[model samples]
Target chain A: MRSEELIGELTAGLRPVRRMASPARQAGLWLGLAALAVGLAVLANGLRHDLQERMLMPQEVGQWLASVLAGVLAAVAAAMLARPDRSWRWVLLPVPALIGWFGSLGWGCLADLARLGPMAGQIGTSWGCLRFILAMGVPLAAVLFWLLRHAGPVRPMPVLLLGGLASAALCSAGLSLFHHLDAAVMVLLWHGGAMLLLVLAGALLGRPLVMRRQA
Target chain B: MSRTEGEWEAWMAAAQAGDAAAYDRLLRAALPLLRAVARRRIVNPAEAEDAVQDALLTIHTLRHSYEPARPIRPWMVAICERRAIDRLRRQGRRGGRETPIDDFGETLAAPGANKGEERVAAAELRAAVAELSEPQRTALRLAKLEDLPLTEASARSGMSVGALKVATHRAMKVLRRRLGVEE
Candidate 1:
């Protein structure tokens, strides 16, 4: 089509549109809504019996903070990436937090190994963690995807990857609040694996999930 | 032309509010800049024009992503760059699979059919190339004008393959800019 004709068609079709909220603001909204949903899920499942004591432990605190930070940062990154002008470095926002999360998990695993010899990293039947992540993570992811869908991310892979990470990380953090599994290796394997799976799922669904709806 | 402070930003803000005149003004003003950026990567005029149109359409659809408070040029440039890259990739893929239906053999057999035009273009290119830096000139001569392999170019130029590639890329940019195809 000729440039003039296209410009005419576009200008003729113009309609008022609500500007997309800033990435930080949208992420904040997602964080708030996600926190509320996860909190409700935790409440329904009931908090861990030793929640107060676990909160006092350095490793436990570190793990919780790391999970929360990773989730929040990933959500922010996902939101930021919806804009074409945003730097790719925004996608790396969650790296430090993820490192902290892994460090905490490794520290716990090492402590267990020192204490329980070969029995420390036992793989148990904790399918509940997987179930929890899917149950809670899916809805959180759906909400995030819905929020970002309108913006139509230029490169959807990283946005979806970060969104998935945000959802899973938040769910895992919530899981620690309620679920009473003390096996670091089990939590790392199950929880971390669940997060990885969610991220992969999001990435695979990238193009479809964030594509702008055709008129 | 000089613009008033935040003129484009104000126009974009108005465009979001469904002001067609403001939107038209913004699009018209942005067209040349978008075209220039597209032409930087897409040498073919038709493909570059398509890239520019694609970018404008993208800007229309994703207008809501524009923040009125921010500078508009970077956002527009990024979209244009993405469209240009997409066109280049599409061209590359199609180039590998498709052949031209119109064979040039008959045309080439005709005496001096396009010779005058070709000479004019070649002279223009040479003039532009002569203004390039020494490294850039050599890189263009070896890698592009002579169509030599990078290894051969590197061997002849005493520059690393990586350096030769950079020099060639910079040379192309200079040539494009000098030829008034790109900014």
Candidate 2:
């Protein structure tokens, strides 16, 4: 259609629209819902027996805090990406927290390797962790996508990449609360692997899933 | 009249409030800016126009995302740029698989062999099929002539799907050889 004609049609169809809340506000709402979901999942799965002792260690505390922070920042980043005027730099919001997350895991891995030698690298198949993360992460991703779908994000791939990461990070943190695995290598392999899978799934499916709403 | 940045912002704010006149003015005034932004990414004039339309549609859908307090130009420009790039990518994907009508100098001839030649070919195919073994003939009839799926063909012919497939393959090969067609 001609630009002038489109203007006429759009104006004719115009309706009052309540402006969306700010990105930070949206992120907060998403995080609140996500926390509730995680809380329910933890309740069903039951908390780890060593949860109290693990909280006492500084390294464990750092990892937990970093994971939660990364999830929070990633959710904010994904929300910011929905705003057309928002700079691409919003994608970097979770980087510092992610570095901290990986750093804590690396430190733990080193400690395990020093203590257990080759036994530290003995990674077993944790189908339960995979199932847990997917169960929690997929719903969280669906909710995030629903929340941001109205924005018709211009950068859907990056938005979904961050959004998927946010969901996975939060779910992994929740997993730590219920499923006990002391070795960081095990956590990195199983939980980190699941997170990678989710991120890739989001990026691959971004154009089709998000662009459907866009069109 | 060309609108100032603040005016554009005000107009968009009004647009969100269902002010039709303000929305029309805002969209019309933004056309040239959107055009310029689209042209930066899309070299073809028609494609650039398409990008502009796409950007406008996106703007309409996401009107609520436009914060009244923020400058509108960047928001508008970003939408135009992204839409243009999206159009270019789509065009690139299509270019590989499609031949444009303009690429041809003249209209192509009518489809297929002439009527007489087609009839002769059909008769020869029928004769060849008649000469095939019973299993091959049934395979050709059920699977090829009827265009039934392998499973259905197998069920009708009382042969396994794998056997149906093999028979069909052999039948086609024999027919091709009998008709002196190339592999």
Candidate 3:
């Protein structure tokens, strides 16, 4: 159709569209829902028995703080990426936070190397930790995805990555609050592994699942 | 005829509130800019028009997402350029099986070809091609009728090779439709 004809046809039937929430507001809403989801998971699983003692450890405290920071940064990045005109710069905004998160894990691993010698016979792998992170991640991811449905993300892969990371980070932190584990290796392996998997899944599925509808 | 960014934003904001007149004004004001943007990326005038139309439609659907405080030009430009690029990509994927102009002559000369029928068909084809828009006619004449190579035709017509291809393609489409040929 010609531009004029198309414009005429479009404007002829014009109707009011309720304004979409601002990206910041949408991010806030997603964070609020994430907090609620994590709270529910905590209630169902109960806090770790020695939560006070764990909190006293610098390694544990750093890990928790990194997780929270990662979640916040990722959420903000996702919000910016949701807009079609926004540059990929927003995707990089979460990198520092993610580095902090991984740095904490690395620190914990270094500090716990001596302790690992005594527990060499027992692998620190936990099926429950994997299950818990994934379980918590699902609803949080769902909420973030739902919030972004109306957004026209030009770079779907990065947006989805940030969203997935945000959810996974929050879920990992929530799991730490409820599940007691002495091994940082378990947290690094299971929690970090789950986050990586979610990010990969988001990149693979993002365009086909989310972008196709918008396109 | 470029509207200031603030003016465009105001119009868009008002349009989002169901002001049909404001919407119409915004579209009319933006169409030429949209066309220019699309044409820069899309060589074919028809395809450029289509891209502009698509961008306008997208802007309409996503108007509510536009922050009144933000400049409208970049948003519109992004949509226009993206749509135009998408058209180019789609054309590329269709794999240039465009009917060669020589094929028309070959068809007329095939076995059991009737002279009178050929003349009539040729006349009809000529009339249809002549009726096309100037850009399409120029492309067809330079690229097909004159048997000029794309580069030479592009130089003669002062259009890019990509645009000439698009015009030729569109011209062929119109001819096919008018001649009752299956696409």
Candidate 4:
């Protein structure tokens, strides 16, 4: 009898045709882990490379502490590997927070990475090594925020792998870019690249670890 | 006296365990689910009601297949979605199958684009809903979106059951006309 009634009936009957959970969160952790392990390897290995040398600065003690922390972190990486299996966004936000904590802890090591004293300092007039150190940690912290909002479902592997590829390409370009600059600039890219890569890798790899726990 | 998360989880655990009371409560808890499911597919009020009852009966028969540990909403969703789809299919709209033409937008006579036009075609169907007569548009929208039953709509609209049926039929006809959708 009425057009309005008919409209109401049709409108009432509709249901969502889809129910699958978003796949990106899991994939994000998977890729994040791969990148994280590689980054840790780079940092731990770089620290080890620097470990044998004798001279110790008051600030250098902080770097040494960093290396020790990295060792402990590496030892327990298997235990930390449980963030990605979540089908929800809320679970994944903790990843960046964890990385940021370590970065904040490394503020001392970063603040002094540029002051090479005599010979090393002779290569440049006041290397901005600290800037690079902070730069390395900042992008990842920022990216974590991007991830909290879910930056358009980047599979964690692709994101980290892309970061790796981008960093490698940037490194070649960076060598040329930093040739006239100082070791500080190089260190900036090196650690920053590693930091960004490792966090992404952890985010990716953590997914499966989490899923294993869930299972 | 308060039902905390622990209590809810414990209730689920008990239901999981062979507690008859838990199973009954769980069944009762799903009363809303039947309404949610039935209200989606069939446009007629009485038909929607009958479909819901039949689905619940089926759920009873299939309850043994329900695993204790897995999430339950998805299980309920699967049943509801299928029952709704089935009712729609039986109403002579055919079933949800792939359309021909492969590309609706690509047929737009574009320059060198390699992608097909199927996405455009699917979108067009949704848009066509608005072009129908007022009654038909309402019926289709309510049935497909709000998931309301036909009888409930009938009461709300003050239209007789037969009149409502005609409105939906006409609405579908108009959508087919606008989109070149075949019977």
Best by lDDT: 2
lDDT, candidate 1, B1-183, per-residue tens: 236438888899999999999999999888999999999998878889999999998999889878877789888898899889989989998997875544444455568765877888889988998899999999988999899999999999999999999999999999899888946
lDDT of 4 by residue, A111-182 (tens): 445464433443333233333323433343333323322221112333333332322222222222222333
CAPRI verdict on model 2? acceptable
Relative to the real complex, the DockQ score for model 2 comes to: 0.45
- What are the lDDT figures for the candidates, one per model? 0.86, 0.87, 0.79, 0.44
Highest DockQ: give the candidate number: 2
Once fitted onto the true fold, the runs of candidate 2 whose alpha carbons sit more than 4 angstroms away are A119-121, A151-153, A206-209, A212-215, B1-3, B96-183
How many angstroms is residue B13 displaced in model 4 relative to the true structure, after the best TM-score fit?
Answer: 1.7
Better-scoring candidate (lDDT), 1 or 3: 1
Identify the superior model by DockQ, candidate 1 or candidate 2. Answer: 2
Give the residue spans of candidate 3 off by over 4 A: A118-122, A205-215, B1-3, B96-183
Clashes of each: 0, 0, 1, 52
Considering summed lDDT, which 10 consecutive residues are worst modelled in model 4 chain A? A75-84
Model 3 TM = 0.72
Pairing residues by index, what is the TM-score of model 4? 0.27
The better-scoring model by TM-score among 1 and 2 is 1
Q: What does candidate 2's lDDT look like per residue over B29-126, in tens digits?
A: 99999999998887778889999999998899889878898899999999888899889889998988965565344455655433566789899988
Candidate 1 chain A weakest lDDT stretch, 10 residues: A206-215
**What is the C-alpha lDDT profile of model 2 across A1-215, one tens digit per residue?**
78889889989978998988888899999999999999899999899999999999988999999999999999999999988899999989899999999988888888888887875355677888888888789878877877777544487777888999999999999999999887788999899999998888777765555666532
Candidate 4 per-residue lDDT, tens place, B1-183, comes to: 344333433444454444545545555565566667677766565556665555554443334333434455555555655556556566556535634343354564556353446667767877886567677777766665676788887887777778777887788788778888788
Question: Between 1 and 2, whose lDDT is larger?
Answer: 2
